[model samples]
Target: MLNCLIIDDEPLALQLLEDFVSKTPYLRLAGKFEEPLQALQVLKEQPIDLLFLDIRMPDISGIDFYRSLPYKPEVIFTTAYSEFAINGFELKAMDYLLKPISYEKFLTACNRVNDFLAARQLKEKKEKDYFFINVSHKMHKIFFDDILYLEGYKDYTKVHLSGSPNPLLILHNLKYFEDLLEDKEFIRIHRSYIVSLRKLNTISRKAVSIGNLQLPVSDNYRDGFFALIGEHAK
Candidate 1:
Protein backbone atom coordinates (compact mmCIF):
# COMPACT_ATOMS: atom_id res chain seq x y z
CA MET A 1 0.00 0.00 0.00
CA LEU A 2 1.17 3.57 -0.66
CA ASN A 3 1.41 5.35 2.72
CA CYS A 4 0.49 9.04 2.74
CA LEU A 5 0.27 12.06 5.08
CA ILE A 6 -2.00 15.07 4.75
CA ILE A 7 -0.79 18.48 5.97
CA ASP A 8 -3.30 21.32 6.02
CA ASP A 9 -4.25 23.92 8.61
CA GLU A 10 -7.97 23.85 7.86
CA PRO A 11 -9.84 21.13 9.75
CA LEU A 12 -12.32 20.82 6.90
CA ALA A 13 -9.56 20.42 4.33
CA LEU A 14 -7.87 17.74 6.42
CA GLN A 15 -11.22 15.95 6.81
CA LEU A 16 -11.80 16.00 3.07
CA LEU A 17 -8.36 14.59 2.35
CA GLU A 18 -8.83 11.94 5.02
CA ASP A 19 -12.14 10.89 3.43
CA PHE A 20 -10.58 10.78 -0.03
CA VAL A 21 -7.66 8.74 1.30
CA SER A 22 -10.05 6.21 2.88
CA LYS A 23 -11.97 5.78 -0.37
CA THR A 24 -8.84 4.80 -2.31
CA PRO A 25 -7.88 1.12 -2.13
CA TYR A 26 -4.16 1.53 -2.89
CA LEU A 27 -3.60 4.44 -0.51
CA ARG A 28 -3.25 4.20 3.26
CA LEU A 29 -3.62 7.24 5.52
CA ALA A 30 -0.61 7.14 7.78
CA GLY A 31 -1.59 10.33 9.59
CA LYS A 32 -3.19 13.77 9.25
CA PHE A 33 -2.01 17.02 10.86
CA GLU A 34 -3.45 20.51 11.09
CA GLU A 35 0.07 21.60 11.98
CA PRO A 36 2.74 21.19 9.34
CA LEU A 37 5.48 20.79 11.96
CA GLN A 38 3.67 17.83 13.49
CA ALA A 39 3.30 16.35 10.03
CA LEU A 40 7.03 16.84 9.47
CA GLN A 41 7.81 15.00 12.70
CA VAL A 42 5.58 12.14 11.63
CA LEU A 43 7.29 12.02 8.22
CA LYS A 44 10.67 11.82 9.90
CA GLU A 45 9.55 9.06 12.24
CA GLN A 46 7.75 6.97 9.65
CA PRO A 47 8.16 5.90 6.04
CA ILE A 48 5.78 8.03 3.96
CA ASP A 49 5.43 7.71 0.18
CA LEU A 50 3.19 10.71 -0.51
CA LEU A 51 2.41 14.12 1.03
CA PHE A 52 -0.73 16.18 0.38
CA LEU A 53 0.53 19.67 1.26
CA ASP A 54 -1.21 23.02 1.44
CA ILE A 55 0.64 25.99 -0.03
CA ARG A 56 -0.07 28.59 2.62
CA MET A 57 0.47 28.02 6.33
CA PRO A 58 1.35 30.03 9.45
CA ASP A 59 4.89 30.45 10.90
CA ILE A 60 6.48 28.62 7.94
CA SER A 61 5.00 28.44 4.46
CA GLY A 62 4.43 25.00 2.97
CA ILE A 63 6.91 25.60 0.16
CA ASP A 64 9.66 26.55 2.58
CA PHE A 65 8.80 23.67 4.90
CA TYR A 66 8.93 21.20 2.04
CA ARG A 67 12.26 22.59 0.86
CA SER A 68 13.74 22.24 4.35
CA LEU A 69 13.21 18.47 4.32
CA PRO A 70 16.30 16.38 3.54
CA TYR A 71 14.27 13.72 1.74
CA LYS A 72 11.55 14.40 -0.81
CA PRO A 73 8.32 12.42 -1.14
CA GLU A 74 5.73 12.65 -3.92
CA VAL A 75 3.77 15.85 -3.22
CA ILE A 76 0.34 17.01 -4.35
CA PHE A 77 -0.35 20.66 -3.59
CA THR A 78 -3.85 21.42 -2.20
CA THR A 79 -4.72 25.06 -1.96
CA ALA A 80 -7.32 27.72 -2.77
CA TYR A 81 -4.76 29.92 -4.51
CA SER A 82 -3.68 29.40 -8.13
CA GLU A 83 -0.66 31.78 -7.89
CA PHE A 84 1.57 28.97 -6.64
CA ALA A 85 1.14 26.84 -9.76
CA ILE A 86 4.54 27.72 -11.25
CA ASN A 87 6.35 27.58 -7.92
CA GLY A 88 4.83 24.21 -7.07
CA PHE A 89 6.10 22.66 -10.29
CA GLU A 90 9.52 24.28 -9.73
CA LEU A 91 9.65 22.26 -6.53
CA LYS A 92 8.60 19.20 -8.56
CA ALA A 93 5.19 18.57 -7.00
CA MET A 94 3.44 15.60 -8.59
CA ASP A 95 0.28 17.62 -9.27
CA TYR A 96 -1.77 20.56 -7.95
CA LEU A 97 -5.33 20.15 -6.69
CA LEU A 98 -7.54 23.21 -6.21
CA LYS A 99 -9.63 23.42 -3.05
CA PRO A 100 -12.86 21.41 -2.90
CA ILE A 101 -11.00 18.70 -4.78
CA SER A 102 -13.13 16.38 -6.90
CA TYR A 103 -12.64 12.62 -6.89
CA GLU A 104 -11.66 12.73 -10.55
CA LYS A 105 -8.91 15.31 -9.94
CA PHE A 106 -7.63 13.36 -6.94
CA LEU A 107 -7.47 10.21 -9.06
CA THR A 108 -5.45 12.05 -11.68
CA ALA A 109 -2.99 13.23 -9.03
CA CYS A 110 -2.69 9.66 -7.69
CA ASN A 111 -1.97 8.36 -11.18
CA ARG A 112 0.87 10.84 -11.53
CA VAL A 113 2.32 9.67 -8.22
CA ASN A 114 2.08 6.05 -9.33
CA ASP A 115 3.81 6.76 -12.63
CA PHE A 116 6.60 8.75 -10.95
CA LEU A 117 7.08 6.01 -8.36
CA ALA A 118 7.24 3.34 -11.04
CA ALA A 119 9.95 5.24 -12.91
CA ARG A 120 11.93 5.73 -9.70
CA GLN A 121 11.71 2.03 -8.84
CA LEU A 122 12.90 1.11 -12.32
CA LYS A 123 15.89 3.45 -11.97
CA GLU A 124 16.75 1.98 -8.57
CA LYS A 125 16.58 -1.53 -9.97
CA LYS A 126 18.97 -0.62 -12.75
CA GLU A 127 21.39 1.10 -10.35
CA LYS A 128 21.09 -1.48 -7.58
CA ASP A 129 24.88 -1.63 -7.77
CA TYR A 130 25.48 1.58 -5.76
CA PHE A 131 24.21 3.61 -2.79
CA PHE A 132 23.81 7.36 -2.41
CA ILE A 133 24.82 9.59 0.49
CA ASN A 134 24.00 13.16 1.45
CA VAL A 135 26.99 15.46 1.67
CA SER A 136 26.74 19.27 1.83
CA HIS A 137 23.01 19.00 1.14
CA LYS A 138 23.53 17.00 -2.05
CA MET A 139 23.09 13.31 -2.77
CA HIS A 140 26.64 12.11 -3.47
CA LYS A 141 26.59 8.69 -5.09
CA ILE A 142 28.74 6.05 -3.44
CA PHE A 143 29.35 2.47 -4.44
CA PHE A 144 28.66 -0.26 -1.88
CA ASP A 145 32.35 -1.15 -1.90
CA ASP A 146 33.37 2.23 -0.42
CA ILE A 147 31.42 2.05 2.86
CA LEU A 148 33.19 1.17 6.10
CA TYR A 149 30.53 1.48 8.78
CA LEU A 150 27.43 3.37 9.93
CA GLU A 151 26.75 5.15 13.22
CA GLY A 152 23.42 6.50 14.44
CA TYR A 153 22.90 9.64 16.47
CA LYS A 154 19.73 11.25 17.80
CA ASP A 155 18.45 12.50 14.45
CA TYR A 156 21.22 11.77 11.96
CA THR A 157 23.37 8.89 10.77
CA LYS A 158 27.08 8.98 9.94
CA VAL A 159 28.53 6.96 7.08
CA HIS A 160 32.23 6.20 7.25
CA LEU A 161 33.90 5.78 3.89
CA SER A 162 37.07 4.07 2.67
CA GLY A 163 39.47 6.99 2.33
CA SER A 164 37.41 10.00 3.42
CA PRO A 165 38.60 11.77 6.55
CA ASN A 166 35.11 12.79 7.63
CA PRO A 167 32.15 10.49 7.43
CA LEU A 168 28.95 11.71 5.75
CA LEU A 169 26.40 12.85 8.32
CA ILE A 170 23.01 12.24 6.70
CA LEU A 171 19.79 13.69 8.10
CA HIS A 172 17.93 10.40 8.45
CA ASN A 173 16.46 7.87 10.83
CA LEU A 174 18.58 4.77 11.50
CA LYS A 175 15.69 2.49 10.71
CA TYR A 176 15.10 4.28 7.41
CA PHE A 177 18.71 3.80 6.43
CA GLU A 178 18.55 0.22 7.69
CA ASP A 179 15.68 -0.54 5.34
CA LEU A 180 17.46 1.18 2.46
CA LEU A 181 20.62 -0.86 3.02
CA GLU A 182 19.21 -4.36 3.55
CA ASP A 183 21.35 -5.90 0.79
CA LYS A 184 23.90 -8.63 1.40
CA GLU A 185 26.89 -6.29 1.82
CA PHE A 186 25.45 -4.27 4.73
CA ILE A 187 24.42 -5.63 8.14
CA ARG A 188 22.89 -3.98 11.20
CA ILE A 189 24.77 -5.31 14.22
CA HIS A 190 22.88 -3.02 16.64
CA ARG A 191 19.83 -0.81 16.63
CA SER A 192 22.15 2.19 16.24
CA TYR A 193 24.77 0.69 13.93
CA ILE A 194 25.28 -0.90 10.52
CA VAL A 195 28.53 -2.17 9.03
CA SER A 196 29.81 -3.05 5.56
CA LEU A 197 31.13 -6.57 5.41
CA ARG A 198 33.62 -5.36 2.79
CA LYS A 199 35.21 -3.31 5.59
CA LEU A 200 34.93 -5.82 8.43
CA ASN A 201 38.13 -6.14 10.43
CA THR A 202 37.12 -8.44 13.31
CA ILE A 203 34.21 -9.67 15.43
CA SER A 204 33.55 -10.75 19.04
CA ARG A 205 30.52 -11.83 21.03
CA LYS A 206 29.71 -8.23 21.96
CA ALA A 207 31.56 -6.09 19.43
CA VAL A 208 32.34 -6.04 15.72
CA SER A 209 35.37 -4.20 14.42
CA ILE A 210 35.30 -2.22 11.18
CA GLY A 211 38.56 -0.55 10.24
CA ASN A 212 39.83 0.97 13.53
CA LEU A 213 36.34 1.48 14.95
CA GLN A 214 34.62 -1.11 17.18
CA LEU A 215 30.82 -1.19 17.39
CA PRO A 216 28.80 -3.21 19.87
CA VAL A 217 26.40 -5.81 18.52
CA SER A 218 23.21 -5.43 20.52
CA ASP A 219 21.24 -8.49 21.66
CA ASN A 220 18.25 -7.66 19.46
CA TYR A 221 20.03 -8.06 16.11
CA ARG A 222 23.14 -10.01 17.08
CA ASP A 223 21.94 -13.33 15.67
CA GLY A 224 20.72 -12.20 12.25
CA PHE A 225 23.53 -9.64 12.06
CA PHE A 226 26.18 -12.28 12.61
CA ALA A 227 24.58 -14.71 10.22
CA LEU A 228 24.82 -12.14 7.42
CA ILE A 229 28.43 -11.32 8.28
CA GLY A 230 29.58 -14.98 8.46
CA GLU A 231 29.77 -15.41 12.25
CA HIS A 232 27.73 -18.55 12.89
CA ALA A 233 28.19 -19.05 16.63
CA LYS A 234 26.08 -22.14 17.21
Candidate 2:
Protein backbone atom coordinates (compact mmCIF):
# COMPACT_ATOMS: atom_id res chain seq x y z
CA MET A 1 0.00 0.00 0.00
CA LEU A 2 1.17 3.57 -0.71
CA ASN A 3 1.01 5.64 2.49
CA CYS A 4 -0.03 9.15 1.46
CA LEU A 5 -0.26 12.59 3.04
CA ILE A 6 -2.13 15.72 1.97
CA ILE A 7 -0.88 19.26 2.67
CA ASP A 8 -3.19 22.04 1.54
CA ASP A 9 -4.20 25.20 3.35
CA GLU A 10 -7.76 25.13 2.06
CA PRO A 11 -10.07 23.14 4.33
CA LEU A 12 -12.42 22.21 1.50
CA ALA A 13 -9.52 21.08 -0.64
CA LEU A 14 -8.20 18.90 2.17
CA GLN A 15 -11.62 17.29 2.64
CA LEU A 16 -11.96 16.59 -1.06
CA LEU A 17 -8.53 14.98 -1.31
CA GLU A 18 -9.21 12.99 1.86
CA ASP A 19 -12.43 11.65 0.41
CA PHE A 20 -10.75 10.75 -2.86
CA VAL A 21 -7.85 9.04 -1.09
CA SER A 22 -10.21 7.01 1.08
CA LYS A 23 -11.95 5.65 -2.00
CA THR A 24 -8.66 4.48 -3.52
CA PRO A 25 -7.84 0.93 -2.36
CA TYR A 26 -4.08 1.13 -2.76
CA LEU A 27 -3.57 4.64 -1.37
CA ARG A 28 -3.74 4.90 2.43
CA LEU A 29 -4.06 8.43 3.85
CA ALA A 30 -1.45 8.79 6.59
CA GLY A 31 -2.14 12.47 7.37
CA LYS A 32 -3.51 15.85 6.22
CA PHE A 33 -2.07 19.17 7.33
CA GLU A 34 -2.70 22.84 6.55
CA GLU A 35 0.73 23.81 7.87
CA PRO A 36 3.82 22.57 6.03
CA LEU A 37 6.01 22.69 9.16
CA GLN A 38 3.63 20.47 11.09
CA ALA A 39 3.52 18.10 8.14
CA LEU A 40 7.33 18.01 8.12
CA GLN A 41 7.34 16.92 11.75
CA VAL A 42 4.86 14.13 11.05
CA LEU A 43 6.99 13.06 8.08
CA LYS A 44 9.95 12.61 10.42
CA GLU A 45 7.86 10.47 12.77
CA GLN A 46 6.34 8.16 10.17
CA PRO A 47 6.91 6.56 6.80
CA ILE A 48 5.15 8.39 3.94
CA ASP A 49 5.33 7.13 0.36
CA LEU A 50 3.38 9.84 -1.53
CA LEU A 51 2.55 13.49 -0.94
CA PHE A 52 -0.36 15.60 -2.23
CA LEU A 53 1.14 19.05 -1.85
CA ASP A 54 -0.21 22.52 -2.54
CA ILE A 55 2.04 24.84 -4.51
CA ARG A 56 1.32 28.13 -2.75
CA MET A 57 0.70 28.27 0.98
CA PRO A 58 0.92 30.78 3.84
CA ASP A 59 4.08 29.42 5.46
CA ILE A 60 6.29 28.08 2.66
CA SER A 61 6.13 27.24 -1.03
CA GLY A 62 5.61 23.56 -1.80
CA ILE A 63 8.69 23.49 -3.99
CA ASP A 64 10.89 24.81 -1.20
CA PHE A 65 9.35 22.39 1.28
CA TYR A 66 10.05 19.44 -0.96
CA ARG A 67 13.60 20.58 -1.59
CA SER A 68 14.30 20.95 2.12
CA LEU A 69 13.37 17.36 2.91
CA PRO A 70 16.28 14.95 3.50
CA TYR A 71 14.27 12.04 2.14
CA LYS A 72 11.68 13.06 -0.44
CA PRO A 73 8.58 10.98 -1.19
CA GLU A 74 6.74 10.94 -4.49
CA VAL A 75 4.77 14.18 -4.85
CA ILE A 76 1.66 15.19 -6.80
CA PHE A 77 1.28 18.96 -6.78
CA THR A 78 -2.25 20.33 -6.29
CA THR A 79 -2.65 23.99 -7.08
CA ALA A 80 -5.13 26.37 -8.65
CA TYR A 81 -2.41 27.92 -10.83
CA SER A 82 -0.83 26.39 -13.95
CA GLU A 83 2.37 28.43 -13.63
CA PHE A 84 3.81 25.93 -11.14
CA ALA A 85 3.47 22.97 -13.51
CA ILE A 86 6.94 23.38 -14.98
CA ASN A 87 8.53 23.70 -11.56
CA GLY A 88 6.69 20.57 -10.37
CA PHE A 89 7.97 18.56 -13.30
CA GLU A 90 11.52 19.78 -12.66
CA LEU A 91 11.18 18.36 -9.17
CA LYS A 92 10.10 15.04 -10.72
CA ALA A 93 6.61 15.14 -9.22
CA MET A 94 4.37 12.24 -10.11
CA ASP A 95 1.65 14.58 -11.37
CA TYR A 96 0.22 18.07 -11.12
CA LEU A 97 -3.48 18.59 -10.53
CA LEU A 98 -5.31 21.90 -10.86
CA LYS A 99 -7.63 23.00 -8.11
CA PRO A 100 -11.10 21.42 -8.14
CA ILE A 101 -9.38 18.16 -9.05
CA SER A 102 -11.68 15.51 -10.45
CA TYR A 103 -11.82 11.96 -9.16
CA GLU A 104 -10.82 10.73 -12.62
CA LYS A 105 -7.65 12.84 -12.73
CA PHE A 106 -6.78 11.95 -9.17
CA LEU A 107 -7.13 8.24 -9.96
CA THR A 108 -4.90 8.63 -13.01
CA ALA A 109 -2.21 10.33 -10.95
CA CYS A 110 -2.44 7.57 -8.35
CA ASN A 111 -1.90 4.97 -11.06
CA ARG A 112 1.25 6.77 -12.21
CA VAL A 113 2.56 6.82 -8.67
CA ASN A 114 1.90 3.10 -8.32
CA ASP A 115 3.76 2.37 -11.55
CA PHE A 116 6.79 4.44 -10.50
CA LEU A 117 7.01 2.71 -7.12
CA ALA A 118 6.70 -0.76 -8.68
CA ALA A 119 9.58 -0.09 -11.06
CA ARG A 120 11.76 1.31 -8.27
CA GLN A 121 11.09 -1.73 -6.05
CA LEU A 122 12.05 -4.17 -8.81
CA LYS A 123 15.31 -2.28 -9.46
CA GLU A 124 16.17 -2.17 -5.76
CA LYS A 125 15.56 -5.92 -5.40
CA LYS A 126 18.17 -6.60 -8.09
CA GLU A 127 20.64 -4.20 -6.46
CA LYS A 128 20.15 -5.73 -3.01
CA ASP A 129 20.63 -9.34 -4.12
CA TYR A 130 24.26 -8.84 -5.10
CA PHE A 131 26.84 -6.25 -6.15
CA PHE A 132 30.49 -6.05 -7.16
CA ILE A 133 33.21 -3.90 -5.65
CA ASN A 134 36.76 -3.25 -6.78
CA VAL A 135 39.31 -4.31 -4.17
CA SER A 136 43.08 -4.82 -4.62
CA HIS A 137 42.66 -4.18 -8.38
CA LYS A 138 40.12 -7.06 -8.56
CA MET A 139 36.34 -6.95 -8.95
CA HIS A 140 34.75 -9.10 -6.23
CA LYS A 141 31.10 -10.15 -6.25
CA ILE A 142 29.57 -9.71 -2.81
CA PHE A 143 26.17 -11.16 -1.98
CA PHE A 144 24.09 -9.15 0.49
CA ASP A 145 23.31 -12.21 2.63
CA ASP A 146 26.99 -13.01 3.10
CA ILE A 147 27.77 -9.60 4.65
CA LEU A 148 27.92 -9.29 8.41
CA TYR A 149 28.67 -5.55 8.83
CA LEU A 150 30.78 -2.67 7.50
CA GLU A 151 33.10 -0.10 9.06
CA GLY A 152 34.04 3.18 7.45
CA TYR A 153 36.98 5.53 7.96
CA LYS A 154 38.01 8.48 5.81
CA ASP A 155 37.23 7.44 2.21
CA TYR A 156 37.56 3.70 2.75
CA THR A 157 34.86 1.27 3.93
CA LYS A 158 35.73 -2.24 5.11
CA VAL A 159 33.19 -4.92 4.21
CA HIS A 160 33.12 -7.72 6.80
CA LEU A 161 31.87 -11.07 5.64
CA SER A 162 30.00 -13.72 7.63
CA GLY A 163 32.98 -15.99 8.34
CA SER A 164 35.98 -14.08 6.98
CA PRO A 165 38.48 -12.79 9.52
CA ASN A 166 39.84 -10.10 7.16
CA PRO A 167 37.53 -7.47 5.71
CA LEU A 168 37.64 -6.12 2.17
CA LEU A 169 38.62 -2.44 2.18
CA ILE A 170 37.06 -0.49 -0.67
CA LEU A 171 37.68 3.21 -1.32
CA HIS A 172 34.12 4.29 -0.56
CA ASN A 173 32.56 6.40 2.14
CA LEU A 174 29.90 5.21 4.59
CA LYS A 175 27.23 7.22 2.74
CA TYR A 176 28.04 5.35 -0.49
CA PHE A 177 27.60 1.99 1.19
CA GLU A 178 24.46 3.22 2.98
CA ASP A 179 22.77 4.12 -0.26
CA LEU A 180 24.04 1.04 -2.13
CA LEU A 181 22.71 -1.36 0.51
CA GLU A 182 19.59 0.62 1.41
CA ASP A 183 17.05 -2.00 0.28
CA LYS A 184 18.92 -4.88 1.89
CA GLU A 185 18.68 -5.98 5.54
CA PHE A 186 21.32 -3.46 6.69
CA ILE A 187 21.05 -0.57 9.13
CA ARG A 188 23.48 2.27 9.78
CA ILE A 189 23.58 2.76 13.53
CA HIS A 190 26.49 5.20 13.58
CA ARG A 191 28.63 7.29 11.26
CA SER A 192 31.25 4.51 11.15
CA TYR A 193 29.07 1.42 11.29
CA ILE A 194 26.43 -0.27 9.15
CA VAL A 195 25.41 -3.72 10.35
CA SER A 196 23.34 -6.44 8.73
CA LEU A 197 19.95 -6.69 10.41
CA ARG A 198 19.96 -10.44 9.74
CA LYS A 199 23.16 -10.80 11.73
CA LEU A 200 22.06 -8.76 14.75
CA ASN A 201 21.72 -10.87 17.90
CA THR A 202 20.45 -8.15 20.28
CA ILE A 203 19.40 -4.50 20.20
CA SER A 204 18.92 -1.74 22.76
CA ARG A 205 18.18 1.96 22.60
CA LYS A 206 21.86 2.97 22.59
CA ALA A 207 23.61 -0.13 21.21
CA VAL A 208 23.24 -3.23 19.03
CA SER A 209 25.05 -6.57 19.22
CA ILE A 210 26.14 -8.57 16.19
CA GLY A 211 27.83 -11.81 17.13
CA ASN A 212 30.51 -10.75 19.68
CA LEU A 213 30.71 -7.12 18.52
CA GLN A 214 28.70 -4.42 20.28
CA LEU A 215 28.31 -1.21 18.27
CA PRO A 216 27.23 2.17 19.54
CA VAL A 217 24.12 3.77 18.10
CA SER A 218 24.71 7.47 17.63
CA ASP A 219 22.11 10.05 18.67
CA ASN A 220 21.73 11.30 15.11
CA TYR A 221 20.63 7.94 13.67
CA ARG A 222 19.23 6.20 16.75
CA ASP A 223 15.56 6.74 15.99
CA GLY A 224 15.73 5.54 12.40
CA PHE A 225 17.99 2.62 13.35
CA PHE A 226 15.56 1.50 16.04
CA ALA A 227 12.60 1.88 13.72
CA LEU A 228 14.22 -0.26 11.01
CA ILE A 229 15.20 -3.00 13.49
CA GLY A 230 11.70 -2.94 15.03
CA GLU A 231 10.22 -3.56 11.59
CA HIS A 232 12.69 -6.41 11.09
CA ALA A 233 11.70 -7.93 14.45
CA LYS A 234 8.08 -8.10 13.30
User: Residues 83-116, candidate 2, lDDT per residue (tens digit)?
Assistant: 9999999999999999889999999999999999
Error of 1 at 217 (Å): 46
Q: In each prediction, how many residue pairs overlap at the backbone (N, C-alpha, C within less than 3 A)?
A: 0, 0
Question: TM per model?
Answer: 0.55, 0.57
Residue-by-residue lDDT tens digits, candidate 1, 161-194: 8899998888887887777877546888887888
Error of 1 at 20 (Å): 0.8
- Deviating ranges (above 4 Å) for candidate 2: 130-234
Error of 2 at 219 (Å): 56
Q: Residue 230, candidate 1: how far off, in angstroms?
A: 40
How far out, in Å, is residue 167 in model 2?
24
**Which stretches of candidate 1 lie above 4 Å from their native place?**
129-234
Model 1 Cα shift for residue 81 (angstroms): 0.6
- In model 2, pairs of residues that clash are none
